[model samples]
Target: MTSHPTVGHVHLRVADLDRAIAFYRDILGFDVTQQSATAAFLGAGGYHHHIGLNTWDSLNASPPPAGHTGLYHSAFLYPDRASLGTVLCRVAAAGITLDGAADHGVSEAVYLRDPDGNGVELYRDKPQAEWPRNPDGKLAMINARLDVQAIMDEAP
Candidate 1:
């Protein structure tokens, strides 16, 4: 296989395109790069699009029923802890409640649902030098409650 490839984009089927746009654009701060009556594309650092939203097939449709096999979640990686914390503050200000937050040894993540009930994860990875490893040089990851308040304190 070739070298590892980065995730390109995530497309979601939303019920209300407008509401979904509000979440990704206003709340999460992605730029609305393109939009149509039933579809939209959003980007962060000026790439074409990092996220795409569409109501073509799912317009007004209810979220997928629970207890079914579907996407676990889409993870958005921030550049640093402070940047991640800044978004956490935005999430709180918008009254979007998080489902959970955790420190996974090599990363810190916050989980929540989108307007259409699609799971989302906002996170930042620790430097590789700080990653936990066993004596044999294997990864040693842990799931622990994250200090959300402390993280928020670093918000810009």
Candidate 2:
């Protein structure tokens, strides 16, 4: 049995395929690897597909209501601080309002909702050597304010 398995991708049921594609491709900078009338596959850096969007069961459907048990969010990891900041700038330029931003000890993250009201998190992990640890050597993650301005300043 393998103890290390990485998350391969996320498949989402969206209301509009084209609109969702615009958000993930245009705003978030993923390339449209493949698409159909009701589905699209997007990826970064030429990977097959990191995100799969489909209108199969949710065409023109409303987003899930609040206080329900469903997908909380989908997190996308950036390679570095500057890359993360660059994406944040793109997000802002697209007029997308962030839900929040935080420094989670081991990573810095910004949360926002997608075009279909699906929660999305964009983040970058700090080096393992920089992750916080308790005196007893246990992980000590913290949710603190992220200096978004400082991060954005690092963008190319």
Scored by TM-score, the top model is 2
- Where in model 1 is the C-alpha error above 4 Å? none
lDDT of 1 by residue, 27-120 (tens): 7779999999999999999999999999989999999999998888999989998998888999999999999999999999999999999999
TM-score of every candidate: 0.96, 0.96
**C-alpha lDDT (0 to 100) for residue 130 of candidate 1:** 95
Off by over 4 Å in 2: 1-3
Q: Provide backbone clash counts, one per model.
A: 0, 0
- In terms of lDDT, the best-performing candidate is 2
Question: Residue by residue across 61-142, what tens digits does model 2's lDDT show?
Answer: 9999999999999999999989988988999899899999999999999999999999999999999999999999999999
Query: How much is 10 displaced in model 2, in angstroms?
Result: 0.3
| Residue-level lDDT for 38 in candidate 2 | 89
Model 1 — TM-score against the truth?
0.96
In model 2, which range of ten residues has the least summed lDDT? 1-10
